[model samples]
Target chain A: MGAAKVSADHPGIDELFALLAYGEVAAFYRLTEEARMAPDLNGRINMALMAAAEMGHFELVSDALEQRGMHVQQAMAKYRSVLESYHAQTIPSTWEEALVKTYIGDALAADFYLEIAEGLPDEIADVVRGVLAETGHSQFVVEEIRAAVAASDQQRSRLALWARRLLGEAITQAQYVMAERDELVDLVLSGTNGLGQLTEFFEKVQRTHADRMAELGLA
Target chain B: MGAAKVSADHPGIDELFALLAYGEVAAFYRLTEEARMAPDLNGRINMALMAAAEMGHFELVSDALEQRGMHVQQAMAKYRSVLESYHAQTIPSTWEEALVKTYIGDALAADFYLEIAEGLPDEIADVVRGVLAETGHSQFVVEEIRAAVAASDQQRSRLALWARRLLGEAITQAQYVMAERDELVDLVLSGTNGLGQLTEFFEKVQRTHADRMAELGLA
Candidate 1:
């Protein structure tokens, strides 16, 4: 299949960039707040470190938007409602829940960003790729989850269930976003196998999630 | 006066490293937490980005300590009392206060770390220098403080007083650490001209602080 051409006025590109920036900003706030829920100083510091990484990604995207003569705040405001609703509907209630959120949520974002990065112009793609490269939070989540599961069977079971719920909420919110932003949906569906590629993308991600769970003795 | 040579077995080095690591961790925590207090999403995201940079520094130090067969947690525990006391005594109570803390606190740290980085062996020094190179947070602090001061004369006075208090507490804590850790004091004094030079070093820093205050219209 031929690569789909995106115009400069492509609403999908605009919506995607705006949503990505807003997501970064919200991740910064939410992760910093979540860091307080850590059981110990070490855990707290680790969460704080992860939260900070989100900010670096935010700067990259915001700078890109500025380069286009777009006001970041205005662009961010455009997608605030959908993003806020997603987060509000999927609040993590415990340490395990938080870890799952960080782990799965970041993986989904990384996958999508990587795919989108491929279709953008060089400068924009570089920014997106650089932002995606800073995935220390995911590494932390995997380690933390493994350690928690190793500590007890009960903890393992609880976290496994929590991870599933997190996945559900994430998918629900994501579908809402895709439905609302046709341009974004088009951009995502552009270079892929076809319009149905999203389903395949979801399957691949779920397989990765399952592998991670099995590694943690959750499966 | 001749520089005092520090003994290889000097417990003060341990104490100093402990104090330094603890301070880094706390700064990482506070900065990340305070990012939430940003009035606007942009400001909040910037603070969070700054907080994230500190985590990179935190990891560098933590890894360095680990490589030396030292447990980061134990080292942090050793200096918890002094570092926690310092922060508690000088907690910022407002946005202006927070900016002052970031400005004065980060600047002093950069200066001291830069000096120490120069004196250490290549591996250790390289990490410290690498961290010092990332001054986005410091720049943010300077900008925020300058904007706040430019906004109002009263705001400048309040921030000036807050900055002074922060320095006062910092010096008090430094003196306490100096008295308790002769090896570090000796290392610092020896690396430079002498005890006399150490006094001059701090004096130079104080003068710079005052200059910064005046430049901000706070003096």
Candidate 2:
């Protein structure tokens, strides 16, 4: 779980890559599913673009895993059931809800990964950085949510709840991952300044989530 | 309807571009829907890649429409109902069915568009050619179908029926589009050698479809 254990078959790094790689694939499909519920072609196309972006990111991480001699499917197997259940439980009921889920869910996931990336090797960190950087869909989501909320107080309140629910589900899934992948958890905790950084890490994610909510007029 | 009437407001070209652009968007959504039923991560990733390819092609055609001073949404509106009906009537019920539908349906549509492209202006023809050139997904479909058929006769028979149904529904939708868009029909007839070539065109498409089916072991 330290520099002494670092190798091509390092359990911590392998689990991290598997988690991130599978997460990207899951997001790709979920985004496509959400895109189907978009109210118009513009929204639909935007969602599709985001989905394609996720797929591109998935290919990057999966390629990284393959280069390490891990089969992508076998590497991804552990996370599949949990991720599927999380998505099933949190299925968006409307176009607006789907948009909110995608925006909030993706931002939170990105922040979590970015924090974890700080402790990873340069190669892995570089892939995470590249994916996090390609978040051009945020502006579109902000514009959409703001416009919908501006249309009515009822819409605003409904979406605020939706955002909260998205955050809750994401946190629950993150917790599940942490519980299941001890190696990955150890990697993140050790990679940070110390064990104390876990509290600081979560606080940072919360701050960003609140800032994002305020930006969308959901504060 | 003739060469003398071709201008900035040419109904034939406008309708053609509109249909083509909207068709790509529809296919993007349909491909995503089909991808969800994929049997494995590899298959899912492949379907997603195909969906993303359709989206890329959509942007190309939509950009062409914009260059001609037509708004994409407005251009696509005319074909919405007809294309929606086509998809609604031919929803695939399984992975094999989806694959067969995607392969046969896309090939038939490509043949139709290629025939019409011959009768279109250079700008529109170029867009059609680019879109048709992105048929890399066909080989994946062929391999998957052949593997399934080789595994069992029951699965092969089922997929063969699915392919025939997909073809039948596609032809029905094409007829519907022809009946609905008189301008597009006129454009094809006037731009091609004449009405006599329409029969020759369908024969060519049918020939290609038969060859594709044989290649997939569905003959």
Question: What DockQ does each candidate score versus the true complex, computed on alpha carbons?
Answer: 0.52, 0.56
Residue-level lDDT tens digits of model 2 in A164-211: 887778778887888788887777776775668777777788889999
Best by the TM-score measure: 2
Q: What tens digits encode model 1's per-residue C-alpha lDDT throughout A1-219?
A: 235644555566667778888988777667767766788877777777777677777788888788777898888887888777767876888887787777767776776677666666566667778766665556667787888889988988988887777667767777788888778788777745466766877786677777767865678
| Model 1: DockQ vs. true structure | 0.52
Candidate 1 lDDT score at position A51: 73
Question: How big an interface RMSD has model 2?
Answer: 1.4
- The C-alpha RMSD in Å for every predicted model, in order, reads 3.5, 3.3
Model 1, range B1-219, lDDT digits (tens) per residue? 233444434444455455667777787677765655678766776666666777777777777677667788877786777777878887777876876787778777667666644455555556667655565656667777788788888888788888888778877887787777677677677556666777877787788778877765688
Q: Quick one: best DockQ, which candidate?
A: 2
Model 1 chain A weakest lDDT span, ten residues long: A1-10
lDDT for B179 in candidate 2 is 80
Q: What is the lDDT of residue B73 in candidate 2?
A: 88
Model 2 misplacement above 4 A: A1-10, B1-10
